[model samples]
Target: MVKCFETGAYVLNGREIVKDDAEAQAKLASMLGQSADKEAAKQGTMAYGVIQAHNHAEQGGLLKLKFDSLTAHDITYVGIIQTARASGMEKFPMPFVMTNCHNSLCAVGGTINEDDHKFALSAAQKYGGIYVPTNLAVIHSYNREMMAKPGNMILGSDSHTRYGALGTMAIGEGGGELAKQLLGKTYDLAKPEVIAVYLTGKPQPGVGPQDVALQIIGNVYNNGYVKNKVMEFIGDGIQNLSVDYRNGIDVMTTETTCLSSIWETDDQVKEYFLIHGREGDYKTLKPEAVAYYDGLVYVDLSAIKPTIAMPFHPSNIYTIEEFKANAAEIINYIEVEGRKQFDVPNLDINLRSKLRNGAFMVDQGIIAGCSGGTFENLTDAADIMRGGSTGNGTFTMSVYPGSQPINIELVRNGAMETFMSAGVIVREAFCGPCFGAGDTPANQEFSIRHATRNFPNREGSKPTDGQISYVALMDARSIAATAINGGKLTAATEIDVNFTRPKYTFNKSIYDFRVFNGIGKETPETELLMGPNIKDWPAMPNLTEDILLKVITYITDPVTTTDELIPSGETSSYRSNPIRLAEFTLGRKDPQFVPNAKVLQKLEVAREHGENPVELDASLAAIYDKIKSIDPEKVVDPKEIGIGSAVFANMPGDGSAREQAASCQKVLGTWANFAKQYATKRYRSNLINWGMLPFEVSGDPVFDKDDYVYIPNIRSAVLSGQPEIPAYVIGDEVKAFTVKLGSLSKEEREVIAAGCLINYYKVK
Candidate 1:
């Protein structure tokens, strides 16, 4: 279904693909008046134009990016503001907005949810920040209406911080990166590879934007095709999609693992901005003719079909038609994987129970969040659900508009009434169910959703404690079809429903009245309120000349996500309390990880206080004796070698922009993470901020639990500013390996030597 080009090719004249050859060069010269290959020889990749523009904006130094405005939803903003306060922020340096969408329900924590909302309002008044009260909008929806500007850079704290379809280069990252922006620090990175997402053709009837997005995600996610690169959308297909349709596909680009995305803008996008009352912000963005791309993802939109991602991941995709043909085999695969979550003996993988009279079955349907909560998707879902009951057996359906404005539009257009007449519940905008904060299912129940992800525990299940549920990703149309069939998974193509593409009339009065906007103002006398639960970060130790670490938690998976490292739901409440949150580090993934890590931490504490490490932990004495027997003269001062813990994962730091993944380990006395590869740029930045060594190991070694790996001259190497360090894994056999620090800035190198980024800044 997909094909990849071997060498980088350019999309010439918007229809033909030209390989880097002479005939292609002659054709390019005839068409564009000059040869692109010759021009590329003079200048580097065609992608360099965008990079140079960004570079020149900061005068060729690191761009100290100050976002024009900022918006964050409930699940993230509280911790972001709290971290900024801890780092001595007097007021918001720029326009910062806090919206209460994720935790609006307030089910888990009592008054804490409302308390955070009130706190945000008060902070907006005391300091110079904006507060969008509860139920106003989802984060990205509000950003699209009010914040996005052409050729502008926006940084958000959520993972789906993409507004590329609206002509904005936005990036989502951890709260620490936002905190640095508040403290006036620059975002540093080497230039990234740029991939051209050349689009052509047009989608046939019935295929939605989710279909196109899933097609792209399935192609690029597995092989690291566009990992940590920039995806520049271009070509004639830009004219084929509407603004909302483009937004639907653009938001899911985070799943491709690209650093950020940008797209060519047109009159459709200009109309979108104009309707939202920001016509002045619209600007046409197009790549220079004969632009060079490091790689190209040529997408024929007409070929994309209605698709579904089975349980566990968004990338595990298959066409809905293909899946229906091989139902038994697919169910068997799910059954085998489902065993990892439950101990149900002789579990029936037969969703065939809902396949009454030859139709596949599902238990629930949801159309919500950035992907499905848009005005068009909701209206289409309402039309599908109109006058149709979801039936009483196992089927249920719910719909959440992306924002309050969208809800108002639905009500005005009578779409909300149509959905209510069909017994479909209309919910306020919230990201809860998408990330496991709400809509928990009964054990073994299967749900289909239009939300962003379907990771394990993402549907509000705790598999470790034995409560399990599964989620499958589908478009709103398929979800509605499944609901119509009383829990049977039916493709939308099999059902007849008329979709009305309603015109959107944005109401800016609601924002003007309810939302607080503060920009270019300073409030020096403002005092920050601190709740008892909010605490300062724990002190961290600097790097030592020699280091020893015990393997505390080891997983051999090909990739370990941030969700697995820190979890999502209940743990969010403790995000501001580092030490308290660290108590839950690996609690779900490995129950013994915290206790084991804490034991090693205590020994390091004892050694720091001039006590013998052997007295605190007698087990280390045996290892020390063996080391002494090997070389007595190599024995150094106890303080020179710091004792800590490490974990080994094949690839760590995927999914979510949560810094707690790395910070929790630092608070638990983890000095290093040995992984085959790091998943995202944000997670690697988190490790540097916490002073944890993100080490990479190649090949299979016999490194097991409780194995000791020794790194000699670690501190001197960091202080001496060497990029590469040699270390020995001391266990059953002596093995030598190399650990690279990648490219570290002067400040980043100092941060590693000082044991933590905060410590380095504080001492300096």
Candidate 2:
């Protein structure tokens, strides 16, 4: 079980927790032999140390940090390098690794996937970077194996870029942030709060890291307990877990919506580096004598049960026991929620049909990606399924090692053979299954996976096509248990199997032979291998004097993820081409979003050419007339106002760090996003980087789809740092509302004014 503290607390000597209440200061002072200074105590945290080490700014609230290294998968590297190249970047400032894991399936888009791989290689050669070839490793796996050093900070363009268990503060951000680092620009941020993940008690034999992670995610995600803060792992319980186990728990921290994470390192961590042949990277890291955390999450490992994150989200969690007890009701609830979420007419999401003889049956089981493909998880899974048969039925299972080295270890230890004996297919080190690219189930079929997320469409079912599938997230152990039982939903603990914990030997030669490491050798004369699919970004226009925004899509969901904004799966093949990718934006969530935005975008295009929007589209005349009526004395010129679309969601940008979530919106002529609040800082930053205003509205603004809201002096207001922005929704009558752009740095404002980060760099 996981418990989040309502108030902040102080940790003494890394083990003792003192709640920060009235008498807590006195107790802290007595322990530390001095008056408790909260501000000074904050500096004693491991997170503060790592952040400050990378920070180039004057010691203050605002941080301008440069990471030790950078990483990106194929889905992101091409776009990131393109943005950086346009922004005048020559050679990479630091180590940059481009791994071809996401787009390894070359047949998906003809030559699109491999063309990107070729382009990434040429970029690595020309710009002095590293390129891990297809199936060599996933992004996080490669980084964890070689790049993550204690006290170092790495920034990657993929979410789940967490390597905190190795004592490295690795963050998953958008491509624009990587582009900034490529151009030697600092990552600007306000100093974030650090939360102590105080661990105690050892986990049960059958309970795995995913169980622990799901427990923490369930406790913190909905309540926003650890949102945008650093989860600093501390206390005696960390010693009970292996490095890989810690890593399994760490990578899933993205679900908690934390900014980044770091951990108290021990000799076990040092040994992990030693096994990976990077012993020199090891450094002992821990908090000082006394450190203050803004919040605390105390997890009792022994109390955690085999957990499951139900369909649609990683936070929709339940214990395997609880789920089994109420299987029918839970499936019904998921069906109802799925109906509301997909909302596609004629789509039948009949999850209850999966029940057979009071037992829930799944069609597939996948142990893949950064979280599940770790050596420890795979080896343990193999032990559980060593001799058991996965019966040749409709139920299928697959295991993808995180990296070639892990695969080699699995092979050497007979884990791979054990998996094959149990009728489990062993796959290459690909991130496909995790993000809807691989192992797509048939309509109405259910899959239980050990992947990072269970978001809608994550299992590759196209609800828009009336093809809906179900996915529930469980630990690899439970998935193995389920697989052995012919896909009957079962907990690993329920099966009495001896877990032969295997010691892994790293095969450094796999990467040494396959990976193209151009770290310091830059071939400037190299030409990038650009296919027809890869295209440069379109020229983005600067912010105009005033803005006219048409609400193209309005979503009332409590949270809207990036996957819904811009879908994953086969559509990801078009990621290099912004216009083509933009066509798919909101395609799954709102099929009409593109066509509607395009219609309004035509008027904007006409207005840009000195033609009145009303002249081009007579339908917008009444909207313009209503705008003029809001301020009858002031004359509104069509040319001065930039017309573009806006999207309103209850809470937008939750999952994924793919910049496409915002870039696709931008490419479709979106000017702003009106949300109750942004789910993550990365999403908001993506919007800012793409030159879209991330406007926060309190409660419901009463704006409907196809409504127009005109904001006069918008560009000036943003540049002038105006807090509250007044705008009028043009309907039967002009209705007024306020939207706030919460705290923009001077550079962020300038970037917005310049239209995008690329334009901002162009001006510089």
Candidate 3:
């Protein structure tokens, strides 16, 4: 259904794909000339203008920009403000906002949820930050309505911080990155590669922005097409899509593993800002005539169809049409893969069992989160469910509007009434379900959702506990169709319904009354509240002369995701408690990983205390004897070695922007990670933050489990700043291999040597 061209091609006008080498070059040259002609024809829309604005600023480049305005949701604000306070922040230099969306449910942590909300309110008053009380709006939705601006940069602690549809450049990073911004530290990085996401043609009917996004994600995610690159959306397609349509697609660029994104702006976007009462923020953006793109991704909107990603990955894509045609084969493949992931011998993998009569079936359908919770998506879903009941046989549906404004619109337009009449539950904005804390399914149940991911256990089932379930990603339209068919996986293409496009009337009054506006205010009287669950980072030591690592959990999969590293759902409550949360590291992937890692950690502690490594752990003595037999001169004293553990994965660090993946490993005394490659830049950053050495190993090494990999002068090697280092893996035989450290910033180097970013900051 999808065709990938080796040679770069351009869509001319929107219908023809220029693939011939000479024709492609000619088309590109013509397009460049047209751009120059347009620049001369218009007053704005030149890339040079945007660059000049930044150049005129005191500090150039995407600034370690301290926002004069700031906002965060409940799950992050408490920790963000607490970290700021610990780092000597007295008053808000920006308008910091705390919204209670993530923890709004208050189901997982008892009174702690309400306590966080109350603390946010008090902190707003005392520290001069904005506080939006509980259930006000989802974090991204509120920012879209009030905070985003053209040419301005916004950094959120949440991973879905995208505002490109509003002509704003926003980045979703770890809370520590946000804390650094609050404390006036520049978000340091070498300049990122810019990838042009050239769009053209109008999408076919029934194909929503989510469909287009999934298409692009399926094409780019596996091959790292745009990983760590800035995706600049440009082309004729910009005019074909509405503001909300573009927003839906823009938000999912995070799933493509790109670092940040921006779009070419037009009047529609300008009108959006003006309607929201921020016309002054509107500035059109376009690439220069001769602007260089490190790489290019060409997307034809018309070619995109209603798509679905099967369980376990967002990249496992197939069109709904193809899925219906090859149902049996697909079901069998899912079953086989499910057993591997679940590690169960006789687990039921046949979801086709739910296919009643001649229709494929599902247990639940969800339309929520930044991708699916838009007003148009929810309204259409409600329309499809107007007089239809999902039936009691296994099918259920729930709808969550992106924000309160959307909910109000739904109520005003009768969408809410339609949904309620159909027995569909309408929920307030909460991200728990998207991250696996809510709406858990029974074993072997299949769920179709419009949320962000479908990773194993991301839907909240404990596969290792024998409670296995799966999720499939689809657009809201298809999900509604499936629900209407009583859990059958029906494609929306088969449905005949008129979609009413409603003009969105944004209501700012809700935010005006409930949201605390702390812009241009500074207060120093804030006495920050410290929750018992919140604690400072533990002390970490510097790199030693020699390093020793045990293979705590060796995964041979092609890739290992952050979900596997520190999982979501109930485990999210322990994010602030590093030590307590560390117990779950690799818990699902390897049930014995925690104990195995802890045992290796004890040996490090023993060596630090000037004790013999052999005496500290009996297992080390056996490996030590084998190493000694190879080379007596290579024998190192216990004091000279720093014992830790490592895990081998084909590719690691995929999905989620959570830093706990690497932090949890650091807490468990993991010093290095051996992988063929890393999946995303954010996950790699997580590793750097935790001070773990992210090592790349090529081909198949002769090293086995319990083998000792010795690196001589490890501290000096890092201090000397070599890009690659040679090491010896000693087991039944000693084998030599090369490990690459990749590119590291000076600060990143120091952080690694000092053990972690937290230690670097504490010591600095």
Candidate 4:
């Protein structure tokens, strides 16, 4: 189990935790004072040191960094390069890597995924970038194997771009940020507070890294303990974990809504660097003797049991023992939550029916992706599943290696054969299972996976289409145990198994033969292959003087994830084309969103040509009449106004760091989002990059669907850095409300003024 301490905790070399600042100073004086160390406690953390090394500007305050490397998968790289090219990029300014994994399946749209891969390969040659071809490796795994350097920061388009345990500080952001890096623009952000994740005790034999990670995520996610900050790991339990175990734990830190992560480096980390053929990248990293943290998460690894995160989120967790003992109660709760998430009436997930003879059962089990497909987890899973059968029933199992290198080792070490003997389908390196592209269960089937998420339709069942399934995330060890138990849910600790640790040999030839590494070697004449589905972005107008937004969907969900805004599964193939992808905007959460926004967008499009034919509903006319009644002599001109739609969510932008969540909203004529608070920095950045006003409401609003909200002089207010804007909601009665446009960098403000990142760079 994990415990979160309130802000201002001091940890000393994995031993003692002192809450009193004066006593902590006394303890630090006892250690560092004797040595006459002059380093400030705030700057002594591994996270601070790493960020400081990469920050090329002034050595204090805000960060304007230039990352040493950048990465994007197929779902992102195409759009990023397109935007960079549109923004006058000649060649990649730094090391840019594009991997084809998310859209590698090519099962949905014929030739669309392969066309993207081909375009990426050609783009890499033309832009002096590196390319990992289809099924070679996932984005994060490839970067960890080749590009992660100690004390260097790497920015990626995918959200899980963390490599802290490998002695590198990596961040996952929207494609707009990566495009800025490609154009040699500095990444601007305020210096974030660092939280200490103090690990103690050792995990028991059957427990895996995912179990420990889920425990940490569950404790931090709901309470906002580490939101938009860095988590710096320093503790004695680091001595017990392998490099892979640390990596498994580190990658999932993104789920905690942290900005980035770092860990104290040890010999295992050094060996990891050496194994990846980057011995020079290995360096000892730790917090200084007098390091200070704004907050602390104390995790006793020994007490953590095999855990499972129930449907819809990673934070809804329970130990495997606790879940089985209360399956009926848990199922009832989950089924109720599912009805809200899916919006399907009478859609019940029957987990209790699977309980036969006092044992809970599942239809399928999966062990794949970066968290589950690592060498340690799979090897341990193979041990648990050895000499066992999955049985001839509805239950099935699939395992995917994280990379070709890991896949080679598994096959060479006979673990692959052992898993196959147990009727497990071992596949190539693909991220389909993690995001809903492959191995989707049947309707109403319950699947236990060790992938990154278990959100609604994350396994590919369409609830709106009367097909709803469930995915509960568990550790690979327990997943393997369940597979061997003939689909009955079983924790790994309940099974007696001994693992034969195998040494892995890294092979570079697999990548050399198939992968394209064209860094520093640009072929300018190369032509990019374009599929019919691949299209350029539509032109967007700048922010108008007066703006009008209609509240289309008023969502009351506490935390609306990016997946809910724009789904991940089949819609991923349409990301390259903004217009096509916009159709899926809020398709999962609010089915009527696109039509409503599209209707309002036509008015704005018509006004762009100075042809303002008044086409207003009676409700809209009442708002315009109210404005006219206020100042009839000035005359509110339609030519000077812009019409768009907006949404009101309690809290939005949680899960994935996909920019499409915001971009699709922009393309659909969404001008603003009213939320209590954003879930992550990446989501807010996405909104800013897409030119939407991220409005934070102070109190209850009198806004409803089809109601007009008018903001006068919005463009001037944005350019002048006005935090609060006077907005009026037009309903039966004209009521006014205030919306705060939180913190924004100068460049972010300019991006909003210029309409979007693409337009901002176009004019610059």
Candidate 5:
């Protein structure tokens, strides 16, 4: 279904693919009537043009990007704004939209979510920004409707912030990046390589965007084929799919771990802007005549089938046919994978027990969030359930529109009525289901969702509490099909239903009436609405000369996600409060992590003051003695060492762009993260922004849990451009090992030395 080119390929006129080999120059010259220039061809990609338009850096390779717009959700905006305020920002430098979608429910923490909404509104008025109230729209939906413009770059604090389908290059990052933009600082990065996603053929009838997306994710995710690169979509198939279909596929590009994405826009995209009453934002965007890509993912749309990402990961995919054929084995494998995520004894996943009568039975179905709640997906889902009924059994189904406008359209077109008649509960435009806030299933129940992720504990089940549920990701169509089958795990192709692909009529009145558009109109006198739960960031310490790091927790998971690092769901209410949120760091992965890290933090606190750390923590004296034993000639003093905690994971920071993943570690006195490799650039950036050492140790981590690592003159190594630093693990005797800090920009180096982005800005 998907073919990845082993070597670089060139796209001729956005349609034909010419493999780069011995005869590549000859083939290119024959087509172009001249000698082929690979360097010039590289600039012909749509991504290159977008970057050129937004890039402010004079230097080649390094990019200093200034985005046309910025966006953030409730859980992230407060922290971003607080950081910006502390950084001497008076007003927003660009158009910033703060949407309350993630914590919209306000169900977990009493009045905590609503207080943030009020704070966002006041901040919008005070700082000259835009604010969308709770349940109005998800972060991406609001941006896609009003802010997306052809050839423009948008930076968001949410991971799924891709608007490439509309010819806009959108990147999701941590809150620090957004804060930097607010302070008129450029987003620095290395120029990313562009990979051609050459699409051909029309999708089969029963296929949906999630099916295609899952197929692509499965092929590219594990191999890192498109990691930290741009996936430039091109080809004749662009005319076949609707704009919503393209958007559904584009937003999921975040799952491929690519930096950003862009599409070859056509009349369909133009019509999309026209329908949304933003025709002025429309522009013709296509790759140049000859565009070279680092690699190519050639997709035959017709070959794609209804696919599902099994429990625990978006990359763990299987076609419905293949899964049904080997139901027992596949279910058993998922249970086994679930068991591996946590060490809780008596953790009974029991997915195999749910498989009865040769069919896998599910407990719930959810069609919600940015990827699934688009007008086209919802309409098609409603069409599938028009005459069918979701029987009253152990199964239930719910649908959430992406935005208020989409909800209104669904209500006006009788789609909502159809869903209601089919016994499906329709919800507001909330991102709760996607991140485990709403629609939480009962213990051990299985849910099939069309949301973004299905990570472990993402279904709101605390495995540590002996409450474990499962979520498998499928397309909205198949979820509807499964609903009709009473959650029998039926694919859309197995059911005969005519998909009424309705034309979406955009309604801007909903946002016009509810959203606060304070852009370019600053009211500096407006007071911010603060809640008891909202607190400013705590003081962070600067990098010291010699450092001592205690490995508090060690995770052997192949990939540890941000969700596992800090968690999402209920803890989101505490995002604005750094101290409270840090308490939950690694709460599920390691319950002892907080207490253990705090012990080291106390020692660090004592050392920071006049008090001696060895006196406070008697065991630390032995650690300092071992550190001095490493270099008998060189005297090592415990008073001069900076004491802190660290965590060791094989490959950490996979899923979300939540800064809390790194910020929580910073809050808990974490000074370093030892990983074989980082899963995504955003995670590494978060670590650097929070002033943590993103150390990559090849092969086995020489240190174990609770072991101490001492690095002398660490501050000099960071500021003097030292990529590889010498360190010794403290055991019976100090053992030598080397850890490499990957390439850091001058500004990034300064940020680390200053302790964090906030502290770096403080001096400026």
Candidate 6:
């Protein structure tokens, strides 16, 4: 269904794909004049126009993007506003929308979530920002309905903040990026390569947006085909899809590990804006004739089927038919993978046991959040459930609309009534199912969901607490088809079905009534209402001359997501309190990490108070005694040197773009991270913004837990713009290694030198 180009390809207005490298280059050379170069050809891309419009880079090849607007959810807005407030921001310079969708349920944190919501309203009032009330709309939904515009750029704190299908280029990053925009600082990076996603043929009936997205993810995710690159869609097939169909595919582009995505806009996209009462926001967008792309992914939409991503990850995918062929083998592999992901006694995370006769059974079905809760997906689901029932044999289903407007339309069209009559519960707009806050399945049960992610412990299963449930990602169509079968696994395409094809009529009344439109209004006198759970960030010190770090834990997993770094579900409520949130760092992946990191933090904290920490931690005393023989001056003073802990991973930072993944480590005295390479740019940015050195080491894991790594004159090396810094791994003997800081903008260096982004602004 999806074919990836290993080499560069020439996309002729997005449809034709040339497989050969030499032929593509020759064609490009012929199209351009004799003076044409690769640099100039890159400008022909549609992404270039939007990126260039937002770029403020002094020199070419680098981008200093100032997004037209910014957005965040309850899980992220507090930290972003807090950082901006600390960095001397009085008012929002652009439209900053704070949506309360992630923590809207407030089931766990006892009034903590509500406290954050009130604080967001006050911040929107005082800082001049927009605020969406709880259960009104998901974060991306609000952005799509109000904030997105053609040729405009948007930076969001959530990883899935993609709106490229509507001619808007949206990039999701960590809180530090949003905080940068709040303070009028540029988001700096080298120009990302644009890969052409050439689509052809319309999707067959029963194949939804999630299926197309899963096909793309299954093709590109494991191979790193489009990692950190823009996937520009331009093809004749775009006109065949509805705006919502395109949106469903575009939003899931984050799972492909692509930087962002954009598609050629047509009347359907224009109508999308018109329906939302923002016709003025629509504009024509397409690639230039004979545009050059870094690579290409040619997708035949007609070949796509109802897809399924089995337990533990979204990338671990297989078609429903393919899974049914080797269910036992796949289930056994997932069981083994789950064992490695979850470390607990008697934690039986088994899907093989769920298998009955030759069919797999699921206990729950959920179609919720940005990827699943679209009007088209739900309408088709209701059609499949019509005159049928999701039998009450321990099998249940829930549907959540993306926004109140969508919810109202569903009710008006009778889709809600059909769903409820079929035993599928219809619910309000919430992002709970996507991030493990609502509709969690029972222990040892299997759930087929249409949510965005299915990461370990993502389904609200605390594997460490002896609770484990499996979640497999499937399209809403297939999920409903399975629902009608009494949870017996079935593909929607195989089952004859008809879609209602509901014409969307957007209702703006909900936003006008309940939402607080505070953007562009000045109310600086409004006081911020702080709850007891809301706490100030801990004071961070300047980077020390010589940094001492102990390798606390080594992660051998091929990839480490932000969910593993800092768990979601219940842990999201503590994001406002840095110290409290830090306690959960590596809480799921490695339970020993917090204690080890906190023990290392004690030395740094003690030294800040002018106390010798060698007496508090005897292990540090032994390391210093070893350092004494190496130092010519024999000066290992606690004040001049910073003590911290580090984690070594093959590749870290996938999944969510949560800053807590980095900030939590910073609060616990993490001075640096040693990795082969970071999975996403946002993860590395989060580390740098929190004053943690993002070190890329080429060698294998030569050190273990409690092993010391000493980097001398590290601060000076960073300020001097040295790309590669020398460091030593000290055990009984010293081993030398070189760590590379891949790329750092001028301001990024300043952020590191001053200990953090906040301190950088304070010092400036």
Best by lDDT: 2
Those runs of model 6 whose alpha carbons end farther than 4 Å from true positions after fitting are 25-37, 343-346, 631-634
User: Candidate 2 versus the native: TM-score?
Assistant: 0.99
Please state the error at residue 684 of candidate 2 in Å.
Answer: 0.6
Clashing pairs in 6: none
Per residue, candidate 3 scores C-alpha lDDT tens digits across 1-764 of 23344553343332234453556556655765642222232222232333234332354333223443555676567656665666666677666667777777777666666777777777887777777777778788888888887776677767778887776777777666666667766566555666667788898767888888888889988888788777777778789998888989999888888878888888999899888888887887665434445556788888888999998888888898888788788878888776766665555566778656666778999888778898888877876776788887767788878888888998999998988888788888777678887787888888998988898889998877767888999999889888888787877767887788777788889888878776556555656565666666666667787787776677877778788988788877666566887888987788888898888888888777788878866767666665555457875576677889888887887777677788788888889988888887667777776788888778875467667787666777776778778788867666777888777766777778888765667678
lDDT of 1 by residue, 252-349 (tens): 99988999888888899999988988899888777654566667788888888889988878888989998888877887787677565333455444
Report the C-alpha lDDT of model 6 over 482-521, residue by residue, as the tens digit: 9998899989988998787989999898899999988778
For model 5, the stretches where C-alpha displacement exceeds 4 angstroms are none
* Reference-based lDDT, residue 183, model 4: 90
Q: In model 2, which regions exceed 4 Å deviation?
A: none
lDDT string for model 2 (1-764, tens) is 78889899989899999999989978876877876788989999999999988999985657999999999998999899999999999999899999999988986779998999999999999999999999999889999999999999999999899999999999999999999999999999998999999999999998999999999999999999889999999999999999999999999999999999999999999999899899998999999988999999999998999999999898999999999999999888988988888778989989888889989888999999899999999999999998898998999999999998899889899999999999999999999998899998888889999999999998888888879888899999999999999889999999998988888899898888888888899999999999999999998889997899989899988899999999999988998999999999998889999998898788888877888887887787777777888778988887778999999999999989999999999988999999999999999999999999999999887789888889988899999999998988888888899989998999999999999999999999
TM-score of 1: 0.94
lDDT of 5 by residue, 511-601 (tens): 8888999988989999889998889999999998999998999999999999999988999999999999999999989999999989988
Full-model lDDT, candidate 5: 0.91
User: Which residues of candidate 1, in runs, are more than 4 Å off?
Assistant: 12-16, 21-23, 37-51, 56-67, 337-357, 629-632
Q: Please give the CA lDDT of all the candidate structures.
A: 0.77, 0.92, 0.75, 0.86, 0.91, 0.88
Model 5: pairs clashing at backbone N, Cα or C within 3 Å? none
TM-score of each: 0.94, 0.99, 0.91, 0.97, 0.99, 0.97
**In candidate 2, residue 643 scores what lDDT?**
93
Candidate 1, residue 709: lDDT: 79
Better of 1 and 6 by TM-score: 6
Q: How close is candidate 6 to the true structure, as a TM-score?
A: 0.97
lDDT of 5 at 428: 89
Please give, for residues 705-726, the per-residue lDDT of candidate 4 as tens digits. Answer: 7788988889989989898889
